[model samples]
Target: MIRSVTMARAVAAALLLLAGAVRADAGATFRAQFGDAFLDRYWALQPDAAIAVGYYRYAARIAVPDAAYRARRLAFLERSIAALRRLPEAGMDAAMRTDGAVLLSQLEQERWSLAEFREWQWNPSLYNVADAFALLLNTPYAPEAERLRTVSQRLTQVPAYYAAARAAIARPVREQVQLAMQQSQGTLDVFGEALERQLAGSALRADERARFLQRLRAARVAVEGYIAFLEALDQRLARDGGGRDFRIGRAAYERLFGYAIQTGVTPDALHARALQEKERLHERMAELADHLWPKYFPDQAPPPERVARIGQLIARLSDNHATPAGFYDEVQALIPRLEDCVRTHQLVDLDPSRPLAVRVTPPYQRGVAMASVNAPGPYDATAKTYFNVTPLDAFTPAQADSFLREYNHWLLQILVIHEAVPGHYVQLVYANKTPSRIKSVFGNGPMIEGWAVYSERMMLESGWDPSPEMELMYSKWLLRVVCNTLLDYGVHVRGMQEDEALRLLRDEAFQSETEARGKWRRAQLSYVQLASYFAGFSAIYDFRESLKQQLGERFDLKKFNDRFLSYGSAPVAVITPLIGAADVSR
Candidate 1:
């Protein structure tokens, strides 16, 4: 009887333990389900982001900027985050834990941005329809008819969306208002030039084509009206002596840095680092210039002073140029050379099968910078990356020459390295292989730009041509990246004017006049973004040194590069802790 009673007790205890284990699993399951549900609703409110991530269910719908809906979204996000907070880490597996962290961060950052920063209220360019439409027509993820359907639907929705958006914008930056008006005119051109042609070629029947055209015309008229409204707003601001400010203020700027840079570091720390790097990079460039001055300009003696010598040498490097007509072709021809360098150096493995298109920047997309890469979304397996080179058609002969000099032969080669091989394209290709959707979709912006900048230096270290001209150009590029960080901080935080920014870029960074002017405009248009390149590269370089110290002689560049990229562009802080030195396993 005693033996039987003991056996019964043991059986009950074993069953109870099993039940508890099952409950833990069940709790994790609930957490994930809630997380996914929250993401679905969140993405529904952000149709553009959803479409970018290959979430097709909401592809045809545009998020209406309804005030009530905005309120509800904030509430939903808060409630969901609270629930997610209650989900014990003890219940989560390793993968879930990482995902939970990413989701939580994303939710918290976006919530704060919407509720507090409210860029939608202050920046008119945030409402630009060009990119939203461009994504629709460019991706080709679906059949022609389906893609056209989304485009047509978006065209129809634009006027209404803008109407709703207008009520939300009680105050907008005067510069942004004018910029948006300028861009709105370009959006109409995109419709008439690119999109209209796209629509004509589609397999849509006569009625469908007619329907799309009607909506397109409506969109055109709506945009014109919005432009007129902006004109009035701009003139009013000018009249009222209120047009001077576009800065996002110091507090908003720092908050964005935390969310966007994800470094857990302050802007002051980043700004100080930028200042130090600017000096160091300039020193290196000056030395390289001294070496190359005699080689490039054998007839002319370099200036005795270090500063004068650096300027003269960089100016000489800018002498080798390409015309606008042949420029894109030149870059296309050079892509393979960059590919060979990467493969030869064993910097990172290449998937030869992936297709990359080199093209001119669209008119509407030209509001930002000179060069960019439009990599394929992670959800879509087939990779097609677009390397967009800005056209110099708008410039006069002298202006074009200046522009070409700014993006000269050697610098253009470095640009190719940064944009295509072993940079954004290569890194993102590796990123797609990672299983984390959260990381892939909400990748660190600083890390993305930083990796590209790092690729330039890494290529140089790996003996890319091993020429003084190339080395000098790379050093100048480094200075530009560092100056970019410092320039933005100075503009936004220290209230630096155009003259100071121009001097910093042209004289200090050795940027061509044309490039410096563009940088000033870009600095006005954006905040905290330019800081990413320097800050991110600094973090990554430090992390690499740590790994090198730990791995010692066994450290392999290719293996490290491949593994680092496999984290799918998570914040360096997030990735650093995740990829511990103790774990060498793939």
Candidate 2:
């Protein structure tokens, strides 16, 4: 009996060794086949995206948004998905597995976008080439001569690019067509003066310079041609009163929410959560306002209604803001202070070597959000991360005052915390450090936005700018986050109109009238994006709290933060399990 048992054990051990060998071989094969070849093909199909991500080999290639190119892209996506699925799961380590999943999700989303959702069919603004051209001019990724040469090559394709765009667009959404006209007109600057400046600085031979100048003029004409096409479309739609509806409706929004968020929470559930969160925030804000009422009002009794009291207090606080002329300068000055807060608090280890620059938003990229972080590609980890703030330079005096009040001093600090320090900039710096290029490149939207939203609260909790007034303003700021989800879900899914949306923002959320109007316009122009801030923040904050409970006294804040960010910009759903397993094992 003992001899028989020993023989059986030996047989089992040998089988295990064979399985290990199979896994190792599978891993090697998968990497060898998919690593470089797949990326080269993928980047070739998406040259502008390649430029954005620091893949410079495709810098001069321009993708034509025509039916044939799209069909080819769809086929590529399907084949890649199939190829990824063929890889043995046992072969991949935790990081590799996560990367594989991230890449797969990205592929599936793109496929759905082309085959099912088909934004390319309806969204005229999707065809803008200015951002790519602007990147070539401004990114400093290559030397002036090399970048200018790329511009010259890319200009050759501009006419064909716009021709394809014009053909592809049919019965486009009215809001999107208007946006396309504005943006396309703005892009003429990049091709004209911007190109002229670059050409003036370039050492292109006399002949090359002449050809470059000629191409520049042609590119400008092509851009103007596209704008003219949009204007004609607009006029036709205006006369006929026929255009595609901006609302994506419930089905498309739900599907997109799944792909973009990946939080394992349904849009219905997230919407419900936002409603509950809004109520809780309103209650908290009211309490704080009540607490500070006597100080601010001195003699008058507080309003009996909850919103009225909160509104009164916020109105008083809004007065303490920068003038219109000082808004841009104020944002720039806040960056250093935010840097010091994170360092002093030891919130997370920051890499000062990674540069973050504050700059005005490029004209081609304006009309979306007021501020955004332009992070370097994972491939170019050391490049500058621009904090692009849309200046109020052209706003009328009244418009500027309303804008300044919306971004009052206390709220502006929270904005910087969200946009710059310990927010998008800090998280992206760490995302670039992550070894998985897939996770860094196919970054989860909710994860990126969530970390930024979370950073706002995190900084406040760490006692930066500790004051009752700051606390009150943060509650109001956080209400905006919650309202983003509510507003997006309302507009896209429930067919919410402008009047209702404006009231939700201006009344319930205490946003200024100008802010409310802007958000209403933004909501129409985009879908499933505003909710990202709330969905991401909730998942990340919940994960941290759950970890705190699990670890008890042993839970270290800095370690927890650093380790959480180490996973790159992956879905919080994926990172939570890895974090839990790692902590439990430790």
Candidate 3:
């Protein structure tokens, strides 16, 4: 009986090994047959997107985004979804299974955008071609002459691209049209000095340069015509009130929120959570403000109300900010300080080879966020990640002062932590090194934004600068994150008016008036995006705490952080299960 039992156990172990080997073979076959083909076709249909994602093979081509192209793209998505569903999942490894999920989500999202959301009909900003041209010029993935040649090839399509864009519009959004006008005008810079500088520095032959210059002129003409088209659209909409409302109502908002945030939580639930978070953060900020009241207002007592007290302290601290001319330079100086802090604390490993470049935000990409990190695609990990800061030179003195105060001394450090070292920049570096290409290319937005939000609080918690003033400012910054969700859900899902939204920002969130106004505009222009910060932060922070509880003393900060980021920007919901499974096995 003992011999028989041992032989049965041996047979079971052999079967398990055989199953694992078979699954590995199946995963390899699935990738070779479908995964590669899907991306190749996807890139061809989305040349601009391909360029953005480091697929340079289609650098010279541009999709017109007309009806025929939309139909083809839709067909491609449907076919790919079906093909993916037909494959048996039992034989796939965990990583490959995650890739399949990411790819499916991507395809489904695109199909929804094309079919239901239908931004093409109402968003004139969707048609900008200049940014792609600028990217082809800016990214150093290829040699100057070679990139220039590709730019010339791509320039030939600009006329048709804009023409198709002009034809595609039905009842366009007023704010979108205005934004398109600004961005399209700004795009002219790509053809002017930016292109001229590239031409001057290029090693192209004189004849080649002349031909490229001619193509550039033609593209410039096309862009100018498109801008004129937007101007006319704006005028007509103003006169007739024919433009569609910018607010995507609750149903659309909920759908978008689901796609944008893959978590099971509803938008209403997130909004409720954010409202509660606001109160919690307010209590904390008031406590910190009370602690620092004697330092800043040594003779005076604190205000009776929590909001007033917090606002009073933040207003006083706001005065300690950089000058308008020095704003960009101050941001540049903060990067090294942040890197040093991350290293000294041993928070996460730093890659010196992946240098971060701080530059003024390019003309074509301005008017939305003040600061953003443009990381290289997973395919091009060696390229520098740009920390793009919008220049304050264009702002009026009042606006500049307001903007400067909004990003004052202590909060500026938090912003650097959020956008640069140990935030989006560091997380992206790790994401690029992830093994699965699908996870990187189809990276989830909430996961990306959430990790940055998480990093800000994580830094202070880990003792980066534990001053009372820094703590108060961070509380204010964190309130902004919570309020981002409130503001977004309020405006889009709840029909929140501008005055009410501004009140939420200035009164509840304690944001500068300038910052409040900018956020209101951002809320209008972008749908369901601001929620990413809070949704992501809550998910990641909760997950970390849960793991810490599970592991007890075994939880290592660096290892948890590294492993969390190793999944390559998959949605928090998707990543949580994988991490939990790994922990269970351990």
lDDT of each: 0.81, 0.88, 0.88
Clash totals for all candidate models:
0, 0, 0
Tens digits of per-residue lDDT for model 3 on 132-239?
787788898988899999998888888898899999999999999989998988889888976787797789999988988888888889989999988998999989
Q: Local error of candidate 1 at 545, Å?
A: 1.4
Ranking by TM-score: 2, 3, 1
Candidate 2 lDDT over 1-586, as tens digits, reads 9999999999999998888888778778767756777788999999999878878888898998888999899999989999899988786767767777888889999999998888887889998898888877777777888888988999899999999998988778989999999888779877777578668878888888999999888888889999998999999999997788999999999888888998889999999999999999998898899899999999999989999999999999999999866887898898888888888988898898996898988888888888899988887677789999888887888888898898998998888888999899999999998877777777898999999999998888899888989998998999999999999999999989899999999999999988899999999999999999999999999988887787777777787789889989999888887876356323
Q: What TM-score does candidate 1 get on C-alpha atoms?
A: 0.92
Deviating ranges (above 4 Å) for candidate 1: 1-27, 34-36, 197-201, 297-301, 582-586
- The lDDT of model 1 is 0.81
Off by over 4 Å in 2: 1-12, 581-586
Better of 1 and 2 by TM-score: 2
Cα deviation at 182, candidate 2, in Å, is: 1.2
Q: Write the per-residue lDDT of candidate 1 for residues 1-586, one digit (tens) a residue.
A: 9999999999999988877786578556755565456567777888887776666667777777768868977998798788778776765656667776777888888799789887778788877677767776777788878989888888888888788767777678887887788788888886885677888888999999999999999988888888888888888888885554777778888878888887666899989988888778778887888777778788997777887899888787788889879888888998888888888888898988786789998777776778898876677747467889888888888778888898898888888888988788888887777877777877788889888988888888898868878887888888888898989899998999999899999888888778889899999999899999988888888888888788887677777777778888788777777666655423
Candidate 2 is scored at a TM of: 0.97
